[model samples]
Structures are given as structure tokens and as C-alpha cells.
Target: MTPPVPSVPPASQPVFPLPCGMVLRPWREADAGVLVAAYEDPGIRHWNRPEPETPDSAVARIRRWHGRWSEGGAAMWALGRPGPDPAVGLVGLGDIDRRGGSAEFLYWLLPEGRGHGAMEQAVRAVSHWAFTDAGLHRLRICHSVANPASCAVATRAGFLLEGTMRGALLHADGFHDEHLHARLATDGPVLAEPAPGS
Candidate 1:
């Protein structure tokens, strides 16, 4: 028999705050434009499938993301600075395996936000929350080898390179190998410890 669904948390819950002054909160309808703009970044398009993100499509996608949270399988959040215009990016725990206490993580930053360390901060914050608040045991972050920036983010967030999946994703260019990085609940420093002698 399939297991009972996990209880859904209240709507619009605040997940956690990143050190770089952003908060990860539940996605809202208002986030569609920001999300679409972020996804439109050329660097973003280079790694994943292109998003056909018209306003209507964004609205539908946001609704679907929210619905998944209610179903107890996945959670998506907007990452932004502390006040209004806060959502400069999106992050989520996807491919949830509640039975195994594991999940996959995905994230992207707005074009303007790239290279600002925002994505790294967001990844660390979300992974910490997933391992703690969400009671997850392991989190995986997979990225195409062509996207070294994404690999850098995973490394900065303390995810160790676990392995590579040969030809795991077929992009517009061609099939590409993907590196799978992972962090576990038992891993060091939930909040990212300073390097030795820092």
C-alpha cells in the first residue's frame, strides 16, 4: 500500500533566511513576473529546458507548485531580499522521496543577481531548512557539467560531488552528463561554518 501523505504546513509559511539577506518563503501569485524574468536569463537557458513562460503559463506553473506543497510531496519558495521586491530568484525541494527522507534541489537567480553569491546563500539556507524544518535526511543537487557556475554553487553550499550520470539530460545542444552533488543531515554545520582560522 502507498504510505499516508505527510501533513501540509500552513500556507505562506516562512522557510528560512540566507546570510546574504534573503528569505525563502512560499511562492505567491505576485512572484510570477519576477520568476519569469529570472528564468529568461541566458545562463539559465543554457542548462535546462527553455521555459515557455508567458504570464498565463507562469500563473499556471505557480499554482501547480503551490498545489504540490499542499499534497505533501514537494515545497517551492521564492528567494529575495528582506523587503518588497524580495523575490529575485526561486528555489525548491523537488523529486521528494519522503519514505527515504531525500529530495532533489533546484534553483535559479535573476540575470541581475548572478555572480552576487545569492544563489549560494539561497542553496545553503534551503538545504539547512530541508534537513531541519522538513526533516529530510539527504538532499541532492544535479547540474549539467557545462554549467560550472551551478557546480560552484553546490560546492559553496557544502554538497559533495557524489558522482556523474552519463548523458542524463538532453538539452537543445545535445545529451550531456550531469554531476550529482549531495549533502546529508549528518553533514557539518547547518548554518555554514566559517573556514578554519577565518
Candidate 2:
């Protein structure tokens, strides 16, 4: 008699939420509009690859995110606040190196969602989840030097500015220096608790 084969359990889905009352969940078809609005920001377009941004393109991107999630380790999530209309931005850990247990972090929020601590909180939340759930030892966040806001976000999220790569990326206008920042799992949570009776 042949031995029976056991079925493997399905992989677990990971979700992270910010203290600011936003939840990081899987992207949905309806997220296209909010995603387009967020990507339309000049600062976002300046640092990352240009997004096609049509409804079809958004669906395709969401499908890719689902595929990546199924594969494990590498993942992308839509940042949505708790409300009828959700999914305000996108954040994820990409460029995973299993051997080194490292990955690159990426994120963007809608223009209206900016100026509040949303991005910073979201980054910390995602980083904590990535480190704990994915067993990532380190995460890198690189940005163009011209984008100071991104640099500030990295710093606020407890990433250290390791160094700069001269002319690492060529922007629409010209070549620009790249600022490399990193956060280690050993570093613990970036957002500290409020002091007693502040």
C-alpha cells in the first residue's frame, strides 16, 4: 500500500495597522482612484517609477501584489483608513534577499494625507510587521537627495542615514544623488510611547 501524502497548510496573510487609525490591507479593485490621486503628487512621481495609473493598470498592479503575497517574503499593501472610502496609499517591502534576510521599503500617500504623521506611522507599522512576521533582519529605504520630505520620513521612522550614492539615479530632469537609509530588526520599534502626563 502506498503512503498517503499530507496537504500543506495555506500561507498566512499579514496585515499591519498604524496608530493613526489606518489599516494596511490587501489592495482592492476600488483602490484605483485613490492610488491614482496619490501617485499624481509631483514628489511621489519624482522619486519612484512612473505609474500608468489607469483603472486597468491599477487592477493589474493589485493582481501582482496578490501574487507576490502568495509567494511569501515579498509583499505590497494598500494603506487604507477605517471608513467607507479606504485605500489612501501604497506601502511595501520589496527586493527581498532571503539569504541575507533583508528587503527594501517603499511607500506613498495621497496629497491630502500628507503633513500629518500618517506616513511616519505607517512606515513604522509596516517595518515592525515585516521584521516580526517576515523574519527580516534589515530593511533599506533609498531616496533621491532632492526629495527632502522622503528623507525626513525615513529618519522619523527610525532609519539611519548610512550614506549617499553619488548619481545613483537619473531623474526626469537630471542625475541625482541617492540617500540610503536602513533599519535593523534589533533596533526595536521606532515610535516611542508618549511620556507620562505630557
Candidate 3:
């Protein structure tokens, strides 16, 4: 006889709290404008190469994120302060391979989200959830080598630099070499800074 479909446990999606006082929650329709603005920002657009976005399109994208979660393909969150302010960033896991126990990290921040360590904090929170709660064996974060900010965030998040993938991605300028950073579930807590005196 054929085996029955594997049973999956029911659980609610989690909202991660960042040490920098920002929270990562499921995307809302109201955040569509922020998403559009993020794509319009010159810095974000140059690096991320996001598709053109409008209010309606952004809402549709958020809906797709919801659908992707239900399909076990992705989990995404909007990063924002605890009040009524709009989301200033996006963070999440994409290209999830349940059977293989792996996923790729995706993120981008708006202008208001820059200048502080918020992205790093957000990455750390997501990594923690990906390893412990999600039960994933491996997670990866890839960024264009030209983007030093992303490199810093990945490193601070405890993802070791694996290697450079030549012409791995095409940015707005041109094909760019990408840095591959990965963290295994076995890795300990995120690295901490040394004491002032050593």
C-alpha cells in the first residue's frame, strides 16, 4: 500500500525582535508604499536590482510572500520599529529546500534603516530562528562583493565567508562577483566583539 502523506505540525509564524529595537513581523498591506520606496532608492536598486514596483504590485508581492510561506518555499518579514511607523527593511529566507535542510537569506533596508546596526541585529535574529526553530541544517547569504555594507552584516551575523563566485549575479551596473557566506546549524552563538583591553 502507498504511504500516507507525511503529517506536519501546525504552528504560527514567529516575529523576531531585534536587539536594535526593531521587530521583524509578517508583511502587511499597509507596508506596500515602503516596499515601493525601497526599490526606488538608488542604493538599494543598484545593489538588489529589484523589479519596478507600484502600490498595487507591492501588495501583490506581499501576498505572494504569504502564499510562499504556506507552500513551504519561503518565510519573509518586515523590519520596523514597534510603533505605527512603516517598515524600514525586509529580511527573510528564500529558496528553501526542506528535504535538503537549507535556505538562502534575502534582505534589504531603506534609507531610514541605514547608519545603525539594525540589519546585523535582524540577521542574527533570523539566523537563530532558522537554525533552532526551523530546524535547518544550513543557511546562506550571498551579496555582491562591491557592497561592503552587506558583507559587514553577513560577517557580524556569524556567516563565514565561503568564497567568491565569479560573476554570480547581475546588478544594475553589470555582472558582479558575489561573496558566499554560510552558517551551519552546528556553529555556536554569533561571534562577539573582543573586550576593549583584549
Candidate 4:
């Protein structure tokens, strides 16, 4: 007989809180339009996300994130703002492997939200949550070396630079070297200075 499906809803998610007034929750159907617009960013299109995405396509991808959560494979949260403000960022653990106790993490933000130390705040919150609440031993974050902004976010969240993998990630622009960073459960909060006001 086949074994029963494994489940890990406890680590899968709930809402995660961040400093300077932000939170990370599951993606909503209403977020489709916003996601599509966000992806229109040249940096986002060139560095992250699937190529050539439409609003409908964004919705489909968002749905898939929900599926990932249900299957206990990933925790893709929609970064939420305070009061009635729309979400300005995103942060979550991808490639969640329970047996191995490691996962790949990622984050991105809208244009207006850039350069305010907000993503750093979000990253620390998500990483701590993953290492603690999610029962993960280590979290790995990698990005194309060309993206120094992502590297900054990773470091600010306490992820130490492990190494660079040559041609490790393939995108529409072709293979790009990746900077690998990692944080372990035993690590302290290496938060970057001065959390910005909301």
C-alpha cells in the first residue's frame, strides 16, 4: 500500500510580522493586477519572475504559490502594508525541504518601496520565522551576481556569503553567476541598522 501523504501545515504558514509596520500573508486573487504591474518593472522582468507575463498569467502563478503552500513545498507570502495600504514587497521560503532541513529564500519589492531599509526588515522577519516557526536548520538565498541589491538584502538579513556558483541560474538573458548566501538556525539576528519608519 502507498504511504499516506506527508503534511506540515504548521510550518507551512500563518501571517508573519515585520518591523516598521509590515506583514507577510498568503497571496490573494485580488493581487493579480498589482503583481502584473509590479513585474512590468525592468529590473523585476530582467532579474526575477517568468518572462513575458500577463495579468492572467500572474494570477495563475499566484494560484500556484497557494498550491505550493498546501503541498508543504514552499511558503510564498504576499508582503502586506499597514492600514489599507497595498502590499509593497514580497518575501518567502522556496524549495522547502523538511527532511534536509534547508530551504531557498527570495524577496522582491515595488519601486516606491526601494532604498528605505524595508526589505531588510522584511527579510529578517521571514528568515527568523523560517528558522524558528518553520523548523528549518538552514536557509539559502541565491541571486544573479549582477543584482547587487538582492545581495544587500540577503546580507542585511544575516545571511553570510557562502560562495559564488558559476552559471548557476539560467534566465531569459542566459546563464548568470549566482552569489550564494546562507543563515543557520543557531545564528543571531544580524539586523542592519536603523529600521525605517513606515
- The ten-residue window of minimal lDDT in model 2 covers 1-10
The model with the greatest TM-score is 3
| Candidates ranked by lDDT | 3, 1, 4, 2
Q: How accurate is candidate 3 locally (lDDT)?
A: 0.83
Q: In model 1, what is the error at residue 103, expressed in angstroms? A: 0.5
User: Which is the better candidate, 2 or 4, if ranked by TM-score?
Assistant: 2
Residue-wise C-alpha lDDT for candidate 2, range 1-198, written one tens digit per residue:
642221211265566667667777777778877667666777677778657497778778777877777766467777777665768777888877755678898888777666557777778877777676666788999999888888988987889999999999998889999999999989976556422321
Candidate number with the higher TM-score (1 or 2): 1
List, residue by residue over 1-198, the lDDT tens digit for candidate 4. 642332375644677666656777778777787687677877777778645667788789888988888887888877867545666767888888877788898778888777667777777777766766667788888999999989987877778999999999897789999999999878875444543342
lDDT of 1 by residue, 120-184 (tens): 77777777777767677889999999898889888878899999999999988899999999999
Q: Model 2's lDDT to the true fold? A: 0.75
Local distance difference test, per candidate? 0.77, 0.75, 0.83, 0.76
For model 3, where is the 10-residue window of minimal lDDT? 2-11
Q: Where does candidate 2 stray beyond 4 Å?
A: 1-12, 194-198
What would you estimate as the lDDT of candidate 1? 0.77
Candidate 3 TM-score, true structure as reference: 0.90
Note each model's CA RMSD in angstroms. Answer: 3.2, 6.0, 3.9, 4.2
TM-scores of the candidates are: 0.87, 0.86, 0.90, 0.85
Better of 1 and 4 by lDDT: 1
Query: Can you tell me which runs of candidate 4 are displaced by over 4 Å?
Result: 1-7, 190-198
* Deviating ranges (above 4 Å) for candidate 1: 1-12, 193-198
